[model samples]
Target: MEIVVSISDMKVTSRAKDVIVTHALGSCLGLAAYDPVAGVAGLIHCLLPLARDSKAPQKNPAMYVNTGVPQMMRAMFGRGATRENLILKAAGCGRMMHISNQFDTGANNFAALQKLLQVNEMHLSAEDVGGTIPRTMRLFADTGRLVISSCGRSWEL
Candidate 1:
């Protein structure tokens, strides 16, 4: 099975398949976590930086990185994944635009996610972030492998 995730969303692919997430990312971010032993992989598309701005956590929780990361992890765990065994990696957070735009959503998004990860006692192992180009990220669940392609270049994470 293959799955594709949209912006500000997340998806967990089955152990027997691969997952792909795409699109133009300016300030948005993409996160992919996998448990190699269990063959479970998850992908999150974060639009903004943090979940702190919202008064209501449940409504539109995907809009914030803080809320979105945890939600994605919970969903993956529901499918029989262990937190300690999972390998976390991130991409996007591209500054395709400039930071002068109001609050600098791109930088804020990355900072928010980093803070959230710190609070959760988790840290990212691999990252391809903070560039001026967009990316297409793919995760292979069977092998717990990740591939990121951008600007005619590709790499494994």
Candidate 2:
């Protein structure tokens, strides 16, 4: 079974048959955490950089990085996962504008993610981020291995 996760959304599962995919992550962020021993995994697709300016974080909560990251962690824990055993990985944060343009979505997105992770005291062990291209992230539950295939290149996360 394959589940598709959209931007600013997250999913966690202990099912061994699950495969999750987040596609076209340009100027966006893709975060995946997995506990191989438990066959549990979670994935989040974040769109914007900051939650500080969003009023929705107080109401919706799941719509922002500040709230969403911890939510994902809890969800994974519910599936019998431990914080120390989670293997973190990320993808995306690609720049969409040309060099002359001032809009640097990729850089800002990366910075925001770093801040969020630092606040939570977590960091990524593997990543394929920052470029002017889109990416497709695939999480295989059977092995707890994340594979990112983008711009004619494939990487093991």
Residue pairs clashing in model 1 are: 49-109
Q: Clashes in candidate 2: how many? A: 0
User: Candidate 2 versus the native: TM-score?
Assistant: 0.88
Assess every candidate by TM-score.
0.89, 0.88
Best-performing candidate as measured by lDDT:
2
lDDT of each: 0.80, 0.81
User: Model 2's lDDT to the true fold?
Assistant: 0.81
| Tens digits of per-residue lDDT for model 2, 64-148 | 5567777888889888898888998988888775452556766777787789778878788988888877898999877878998
Worst 10 residues of 2 by lDDT: 97-106
lDDT per residue as tens, model 1, 100-121: 6667777788888889888878
